[model samples]
Target chain A: MSELTDFLNSSGLANLDWRAAVMVAVGLLFIFLAISRDMEPYELLPIGLGVIIANLPLTGMTIFSDNLSGHQESGIFGIVFHYGLSFWNLLPPIIFLGIGAMTDFSPVIANPRTLLLGGAAQLGIFVAFWGALATGLFDIEEAATIGIIGGADGPTTIFLSARLAPEMLGITAVIAYSYMASVAFIQPPLMKLLTTENERRIVMTPPREVSRLEKLLLPPMAMILIILVVPRSAPLISMLMIGNLFRESGVVPRLANAASNELVNIATIFLMITVGTQLSADRVFDTDTIVILGLGLVAFACGTVGGLVLAKLMNLVLKEKMNPLIGSAGVSAVPMAARISHHVGQQANPRTFLLGHAMGPNVAGVIGSAVVAGVFISLLPGG
Target chain B: MTFDQDLVNQGLTLTAIGIGTAFGILIVMMLLIQLMGWLVRIPARRAARARMAADAAAAESRDKALAAVAAVSALMKSAGPLESDAAVPAKAGTRKGAEG
Candidate 1:
């Protein structure tokens, strides 16, 4: 009878706390959203599973060490969090490399003017940084981490949050990704509200056909220029450009394929899951989290507005007028943000093809945000 | 104060620096792209010029060969008509002799 009672008490059911119950429900919501809605399924599914595993009471799976009691066990997720994120910060660079290998720089090269629009889009990062600081709930370091969510690039948000505020890494990264997915919904209203019917109807001329030699030279040139300016950004940008070089060289399909496919897949799985496991109930259920969410949205909206404003401004001076809708793609949600620009553009002018035009700023946004992130790293004392 | 004046000041400063640096680098990258375009054009332009020269040389030889063939055909055409005329006269002379 005593043995049976002991076994019942020792089970996960009896040991579960109210906070753990709440976190599990949160995890289930993410899982449900992923499976049914098909929203970032690859990222959310693993993260949701990790969240459930971490929150469960009396599980040694996520515990690393308790100095007070001298308890030590390296869980699989814990080890990944320590080595992959905390110590070395290797995951984001690998993801960047994969992004580089798969990316096409022709649109960007054909229209270097779009690079400024990409730079303009990063205004939201500082906007949110200001907002976070104004709230006084977070210091500059934490505020900077929150500010980066405005960039809308998952790997960059993850990299910055992991570097500066390891504690906020989980929630900040999740928020950044969620907002990136929601950009399709969030950007259209802003794009329409900001632009007139005439502006939306603007059709851009097709970009020039780029040469093979030009494509091959871009990676190394960009790598040198960017890294020379911001050495702290070397790891991310170098990997990104090298991956691009492999693709353009026409001599290394196998390397490019592995970087874009196998290497990236493994890193994303480990990185996303590790980030999810760090989000405890204590971290999730807070006034600050609510505030951060509001700031993140503001940041994204401001970023879209910033890009639109620049594009509109550019049209005033330039002879070959640009479609203002393409400016919103500078937020760097990859093709999704660019697609939003194209979609909104079609609503106004059915014949106008904006996807190629929008992609110029879209890829530029990736480099723009990384450069800003490096600035943040250089100026601030990280947590 | 609801907000820290010092933190806000720092934020303002950082915001300026961040925006300035990002734009500066992008502009530099833009100029670099233009410079690379010019540099990349040099080799391509040179190759195009070299190809044009080689084509001119080939065309020169082909035109000379065509002229030689035309001259040869013209000479053969002129000689054949004169020879046929003389042979016809000789045949007439033989006919007269036979008749006599």
Candidate 2:
């Protein structure tokens, strides 16, 4: 009888708590969604694994302690979370490096006006900022990080949260990624509500061909110009542009291929899993994280609205009419937001193609958000 | 974390600065991109125009050469019998003169 009682007390099953079980369930749900629905399988799968592993009690992996000589010691996940995330803030920027290599700037190069639409999409960030402040659950720096979820770039979300509100990194970054994956479902209704039937039917001519000179000139020019204006944006923008330059230089196919494929893949697995591990029950169950979760959808919606409104406004001023659906792509979700615009346009006119046009703003949104983040870092206290 | 009047004021102010700078940079980028496009296109446009002019001149010269060839061919066809008769008399006269 004594041996049986001792064995029961020492077992993993004995340490299970309701909160840990719930978090594990959440992680399992993420894994299921990723596998069955084919929604961001690369990201969600690893993140789910991290969440499940972190939530299990008595795993000894949660250990983060100081040794006798004042050296810090921890498990693998803890080491990564401390050094890769809060301690150094390295992973998100490395991910940005890959993003740059994968991106094509030709769309924005073809039509520079779409850059304004990308700028406009940033209004959602401001709107969400106000919403965050109004809730009385967050302070100014935390609010900035929360507002960035509207930017719809997961890496940017992680980058900003790492600086402003390190505790909220998991919630905000995960929400941002969630919004990015659901762009197809969430954006169409808002896009339709904002624009009339005529606007939806408006067909965009194919973008003009951009010169090789323009493509080559762009990364350097943009990198120099943006970094000069907002010095804080240098690290992220520089990495992004350098990667793009490698892609465009044609002399460095090996470097470009490596950055886009191997470097990005490795960084992505680490970053996503790190973010998921941050969502352990103790950190995620607080009032602030819950409030952020509720407000995440709204913030993202505001960004879409901002883009659509700006496109509509630009049409009013310019001679050529643009499909407002493309404006929603200004939320920095890259090809996802751009595809949503194209999909919605297809509904009104099956033959109308807005993908190329929307790509201009889609890419511009990435720059815009990075710029906004730089501005926030400079202005906010945390940086 | 609790919010206060100071926080609200800060939020509003940050919103203005943040949005203004983002839009400002983007708007400036848009302008600079246009400027870059215009600048790059100048040399290209000049080259295109020069090429077009060269093509036009070449086409004109070709047409003139073709027209001159056509005119000579027409003259040869229309005065063929006359030239042939004249050529025969001239050749006989040259032969007589040489004998005398």
Scoring each candidate complex against the real one, what DockQ results? 0.48, 0.45
Candidate 2 lDDT, A1-383, residue by residue in tens: 99999989887789888888999999999999999998878788888888898888777564566566645457777777778888888998888888889999999989999999999999888888888888877888888999999999888889899888888888898888877888888898999899998899998889998888899999999999899988888878999999999999899999999999999999988888878887888887788777887677888899999999999999988888889899999998988899989999998999889999999999989999999899899988887
Best by the TM-score measure: 2
lDDT of each: 0.89, 0.88
Listed for each candidate, the true contacts retained, as a fraction, are 0.70, 0.77
Tens digits of per-residue lDDT for model 1 on A1-383?
99999999999999898988998988888889889988788778888887898888777776665356665666888778877887788999999999999999999888888998999999889889988988878999899999999998888888888899988989998898888878988999999999999999998898878888889999999999889998878878999999999999989999999999999999989998888898788888899999999999999999999999999999999999999999999999998999999999999999889999899889988998998888888888772
Please provide the root mean square deviation of candidate 2 (C-alpha atoms, Å): 5.8
- Candidate 1 residue pairs in clash (backbone atoms < 3 Å): none
B1-100 per-residue lDDT for model 2 (tens digits) = 4567777677777888888888888888888888889998999899999999999999999999999999998998886656566769978798899999
Which candidate gets the maximum DockQ versus the true structure?
1
